[model samples]
Target: MRVTVSQPTRRGTRRSHGVRAPAPTVASMTRLLPVLATAAVLLAACTSDAETPASSGCDPALAAWADAGFSGAIAITAGGETVCEEGYGDANTALTVFAIGSVTKAFTAAAIYDLVDSGALVTSDRVGDLLPELRGPVRDATLMQLMTHTSGLNGSAGADHQPLWRADAIAAIGAMPLAFAPGTDHVYSNAAYTLLALVVEEVSDSTYREHAMTRILDGFASAGFWDGAPAAVGPRAVGHLDDGSTGEAGDFAGPHWALDGNGGLAMSMPDLAAWTHALFTGGVVSVESAAAIADPVVDLGDGAAETPGWVARDASAYGEPFLAAAGGGGDVGHDTMVVWIPSEERVVAVASNGGDVSAEELMAAVGPALAAGDPIPAPDAPGGTVDPDVAAAIVGDYRLDTGGAYRVSDDDGLRIAALGADAVEVLFPPRDAAAADAVRTHERAVADLLAGETPAGREELAALEDEFGPVGGAEPAGTIVADGELRTYATLATGDGPLLVWYALDDEGAVSAVEAGAQPPALDLVTDGDAFRPADPAGTGPDVTVSFAAGVLTVTGPDGAVTAQRD
Candidate 1:
């Protein structure tokens, strides 16, 4: 989902376009005796090695989600001590490693800063200067523009799992026209981070992995791009769909195109918490560079600003100051949300492996309360106890992920809506139809929509094929109940891109509404307004998966074919 300063993000449709998740990082610091006295004094403490953080409170929403089938880890650190760290559902609270999605950009930004610190790279240098082979509109985009996501790039040059080799990845990005002139506007472009990763390779004369591990990732024992790690590093969590079943084992061994620099690292929560602490406390980069990395260098307006690694907001936006960032692969179901309250020197983070419960949603439920030091409800407290007065008071307009305008509020959780109406779009509209026809029409509609036949944004959408690549046929991916509708999805493709198309049908076997993308984001629930719940239409449970009753399913793969039926 696209998020702004007014709300939590890195999920919704952006993530719904969902590909990968939030990220992790950490390290110790040696006191720096900078020439300036003030700088030296500040560095003396902020740059000291990390002390173990402390754990303090419990959150009722976390408990609610955990009981609701959310499986993930959370890490919170404050005053150089652990606050609360726990794993929920099937995950090991202390040992499960997760794919930390866009959170990885924090490190990419850090690596760039470290290079700057060492006089190896300059933020003002044009991206093209470092990688001459890059011939896209962003060629002249300064490194600063890239870090701030103002390089005129929009999302990806290809799918999150395309696996294009390095040369091809570079060529793909180089060939795409920038959405606008570099430094002219802002769009969270994952491809830009991949390009930055390439710069890391070119300037450092080493792999992004090698350089990051040695320089920026010095203290992260298990945080690195997903590849083999010693057994002690920890077991990686499998991504689960909103349904309790159908968890996926992630594949991070890669051609770093989709995975690099943007959102490709995996690590345990402790490592992730430590990384944020280290970076913010001056244990990672210099204080000045850390500030640049953590705070906005470019203003995106609407209470949002782009920093090297985060999306920052002043007190006016969130009712308090915070530096926020979130990421997750809609496809993998691995998600993370992080909020650093600079005033309290506290970091609150949530990571989830279940698609049904997004970290963004969970964080919204608890982060603000945790920050305010509000009374913590009992872990067993029912999800319905949020004060109605507070809920009403919280209602307001929001500009969320990708800058979508929203009428939003939170009581149970944040819901986006049209002012005073049920204009919220459904994730999967209701449907009842023959399987063959649904599949056929769904595929055609997707290609046609992305190919620019859709009326509203034809001109703007004309180049989608360049970013996600030309559309191809689709295949059944999964099924889940959404708002009580038996919604279904197909693993759609665009140059082997892992895109998704979800739809619902009417009683007469006609499609009601169909949505497709890497993530159209909260486009699913946002339209529901305050009436929406993280539950089914019956208001009893999440919109999750349901097995067919007395129905048959077919499976055909390279090995053979099989059929299953209700006994």
Candidate 2:
């Protein structure tokens, strides 16, 4: 059904990429968008005790996090009953309540659907038809597209210089060019929803935050959803930064801004689990939109090269690449996961203030590990030195600086980059060495895509990757090299074998690229950083350094480095 979504404006609203400033003092230093699918071993091995419908079970996955050094809260529900509710690490650095990010989107979408049910609006109506100020291609986009991210608006363009707040948000998105013809592709734009919040304000005749509090957040309190915003930091588990520091600098620390429709909602794990149950069960949107909302609307399979091995690998393992799902956006300092299993009549919410644990793998492991009635295995972290042959496979020239002119290359085991920084820093993490010894971050590029928990396009990419192979790793014997603009790369096999291939493109807002063990000539490339039409895309190798400490795996690349505990 079509609905009209209007964009609104706020007076004294300072905007930057749709986030209002006085940015909530949230201390978590999160990464972004690492989603999981079913094919991953984390799923196959974790779901051994698959209970029948209506059966409930304590998620053994809870204990798994402690093994992985995760600190936060978790809740599991079956048949609309609270099956498990428990807290792990601190909710805030002060040790108070849990802070929920972008889950606010689900609430916002629900509120919009409520308006539709009340005959106030329809999801199929054109956004521009509602608010004239929401001019340009956005006006041409429908409310459903905006809700589903099929509209080309981006929550945050990769521009670091863009100011972040309400006023700046409106101006930036309003002025930005459409990434694609509206409804032609899905980009997962938070700014689009922020604008939808504007629509909420326009129709409800109230502020976006006010409308949400009244229609959604308040519903939780009325429904026995406790664990409200903490007045003082309580005994919650604490999420720490890599440096082990807390307060404003750490992952879980302080309050930033209030929850709006687009983001900024905070609550305990049980509360969110309850809220999600209500949502999927028709407490908010109609069952029709509810089902449609969860259904896959766009394909994001090509974005895997930018995903970390932990996340990209999981998506390939869990749900089918064709299954539709949503709601997995996460920040670096902030780590949270909620998986609603319709067939099982279950909803599992896993949260943590900590950084760099494989939530998907943990879930996959827990489902089977618990089902097998297997005693929680002694914590055996994932670790194994890569064969020099495998290590030699990924070693080559890779582009480190995204927008820089100079190039970087790696020899045997050492990496040097002209990144044109103050000095030519050697970018590699040390194995069994001091943390300060590494030059560049070990897990940057790999972690960048996995930083957030957005689950929208994971299944699709996981399927494609499964058909291909790992983004990096040796096949038989070969050398990898950048072909043209460093947007694509090739791996030439030593014997009479085909060349491995990969490429990336910026469509709408998300990045898309495909890779295969065998190279394809008609690959697409991004030139001038804007247009990624079609060119022989190529890339220099990203210098990779791997280190293991205390059973943890640390990897460094161009963007940054993250260590995953092998629990």
Candidate 3:
């Protein structure tokens, strides 16, 4: 999502006329020292001498570069201690922090899990049953599918509006339709999660912000959590754009558009680290729920070359590091990477306004530090392909290994399933012959629109749409798999990127699943692995095989004919 602070950004911008100034010395870096120390102790306890961190403060090889480029914040906490805390440039150009784009998903997940913990709701509950206002296929979607992103309400391709005005976002999503049946496949969808926030609001009988503040933010006051949705978060960090400029970090200018479940959270680096610590060490949710969240629910292993951690795609070099147990959020000039280092018994939280580039830098800087027990250099090299052109190039229809269809469309266009709500898009629309034709036509229209489109600040929106489909109302429970857990993969590519729920057993032995989108025809759900050679080379042809390893999936088609892996 493209988020701009109320204050003017750009090299020669100034503060807003009547905004309240940010607090001076909101929180001293020293406050984090104790936390860092505790974390160091914790880390030392968890690792052997070989894995122990270096005693010296590794040179700021990465930090120096970060200081030069973007006005940023850095916090390194291990175990329970805070090892490093610093803020460079301006945390608030006009009393606002950088918007942490999609990092907000972690918070949304936490809040939803709170409701689940309190018996207020369950992930498996159908969207239709709880959030009745939802019509179309979304009505049938389950919260689990939404959380795991397997809800097939919207196909892989749909309209996006993260960087636009809030009304535009709702309007665009409203115009689209679900592209596939719910629980049919995995498609990372911010729109789906944003709608989920609304669902949480309805179920809790309170605003999403209130729910998060009360149950999450407020509950963690001891850990430095603060209350801020539309308002400025205290001790926040500044975000920098690729234009070689920096600005105050905060949510978009639209008042109604606070950090939604899909993305839209603002916080300091220290606070985020604490939040991650709670998540990994059972401070946020119960161990059972945490385990469940981290557990792999389905496999997307067949007919795909490689598996990605978060988004389902074949290539990993271009995408963000997929954290099996962690979550990510970012838009335009804001980003956050929160990782739980279990081997070290610590949580590492890095929030930046440098957009997608931050993911790579954080990984580059911290990955080696954690692995080699050494310090990271400043201004770590940017990761992933951050070019707007590169991101846009991949924006098109992609056939998911799962049974449903997946596509990426321009930012403003809408997508709908056959016979689904004309105004309200769903994960999977009601498939009637008439509606399917219309949906196909809609795809063509969107392509035309994109071809004539200009850089009207919807690039982030386009990326979001490419990342997810339109907001489908309801669907079933689902999850994505990578390897067995959410660890980052460097050299190898294996397993399913995201597992889509395609079939279920019934009383009459009737195999029920969502209708396939525009994918190659397949007969059975079983698959061995991406390599059709079969796990057992001796196995005969017509072998529809499915194998679940570590937590990721790999499927080999019948006769070892076709193979696809979730990226």
Candidate 4:
């Protein structure tokens, strides 16, 4: 779960090959070992959620990012004023709202340049003559290759709140199969923005959320779309999760059809800082539809490119260049980001309805300390609180010295959070005792090693029948532990299909270590000093350390330390 959204948007800087690796499996080597498997990185398990009392124009780096626990809602603007609207914990940067995922594809690329400045639509319109029950090649893509995501359309026509409508999301993108051809290459289509909200409901006869709240957010006084059972009353915010709990709040202002016009908006933070100050100065759509919605030659490499509702980049961290976009916590817990900055005409915009900071990590922790007035760098303090009898003396079972076996118990935040419903990690200190086990015994030792029986401590395992051939049993999939080692999980059914595995038993329960294939693992963490170390989401982890004291526990890493005790 090494997630990353910014550090110059990390997808391995430029993947010509950098971040692909894996293939040699065993559930990708036990998810490359999350610090020996306590499997870290799943934060949102907050300790700070209610703020706003500081005053004197709050901003000591957003109160050291809500005293390090983190949470969101910010505003910022510049050219025309408003340099910093607040809200930190429970988020109220002026009344909440959130759910702005996929930053609604830069407002569906600014309503296709506000429907080509009212001439209705162009960009050489096509999608087979405006939605004619689309058939293949993403119905001959055009409207500038579905407004720059390069329209070979392949990212999905379903499952983003799949309630399905708009003729079953245009018959599921006219029955898939074209991840290529259309304007030749680029892919990130939410079914090409749900066919550009069904080409703005077939040329504005209306309803793609009423032509995006009256013509691409008409005057923008609180932006629109997102009804989720909303007749109106205001102060939204529900969201939370990442361990924090309560999720999805928008309910549906949505012309549904899988979030129409791609990832529906809910907005608010002074209407995303007045729609990034009316889409960079000259007002929303004109100078040739905002220069074809700001350049977009594609690239999307480290210098970034692809335009249409944002992502122009150029190495910011506040060193200039911007025009970004981000939306909710995948799996919907809510988060958003906007950023504009055309040479400081500025606009920052960050949103969250809980799951601690992540609106591009609170716009990279408050846009370069509010563009250098400086103060937001606080973060390190959370590596110690667990008293209630030292979390009942560090829960139970341990064993280690090396033979591996740990099963501590007590952190009742109930498992199930492998993350992404607004990811963040690092919430330690809730009276510890966090157990976590229910063995499928590595799916009955991968169904007795697919019936050929060789599962006794893996017996030099590794044949994967010529890299995976005939296979079909084993399923379970859970359990991890690490340093105080456990592993377990399952899946297999191979013939080149499902794979994913990870067995382990040692301390006499037998089996020892099994390994197998297919990608898996996505989670969170953070805290270092007396030794606690994983705060990921790219805050960087894996040096490993962990601690505990009197009853023992230890951990260390690079495969060296270990410890345990508590039996």
Candidate 3's C-alpha lDDT?
Answer: 0.39
Descending-TM-score candidate ranking: 1, 2, 3, 4
Output the worst ten-in-a-row residue range by lDDT, candidate 4. 12-21
**Clashes (candidate 3):** 73
RMSD (Å) of each candidate, 1 decimal: 15.0, 16.8, 18.8, 18.5
State which candidate, 1 or 2, has the greater TM-score: 1
Report the error of model 2 at residue 250, Å: 13
- Per-residue lDDT of 1-567 in model 4, one digit per residue for the tens? 121111111111100000000111221111111110010000100101222224423344455655454566666556756655677676745656666767787777787777778888887788778888777767877877776767776545654553667787788788766656877766555667778878877887776777777766777655675545322235766775433446555564343676667676776676777776777664766777776677756765545567775656554322445556665543356656565656546665667665434444434433343344444346544454444575566666555543444444445411112211011011111112222112233335444654556533242234554566655566554454331233544555767787665544322122333345422332233335555455433232334555678777665655456566666
Local accuracy by lDDT, each model:
0.54, 0.41, 0.39, 0.52
TM-score of 1: 0.63
lDDT of 1 by residue, 1-567 (tens): 221112211122223221211110000000000001111112122223432223323333456667654578877677657766778877756558887777788889899998888799989999988997877677898888888878886555555554668888888888766667887766557778888888998999688878878888787786776542321167878786433333335553556566678867778877887888788878888888887787667765555567887777655534555675666644455777666767657675667776444554443343333444453222222234444664465355533232323343463454433211111222222233343344344445543444456431253243334555665645554333332233444554678476655544322122332345522223223222223333321122333221111233222222233233322
Displacement of the residue 315 alpha carbon in candidate 3, Å: 19
- For candidate 2, write residues 1-567 as lDDT tens digits: 000011211111111211111111111101122233321222223333553212223444445555544456656666677665655444422223444445556667777876787788898888777666655567788887777676777544222112245544556557656767887865545666666776787788666666666666565642211123322122333434222333122122222222234544555566666777777777766787566556544443432211100111113434432111222222223445555556445665665665333333344334444434565443334333335654344333333232211121123222222221211222221222322221122222212332322332243234434544333332221111111011222342324244343322222213332233422222111122211111110111234444434444344455466444433
User: What's the CA error at residue 505 for candidate 3, in Å?
Assistant: 35
Model 4 lDDT on a 0 to 1 scale:
0.52
**Cα RMSD for predicted model 1:** 15.0
Candidate 4, residue 551: CA error in Å?
8.4
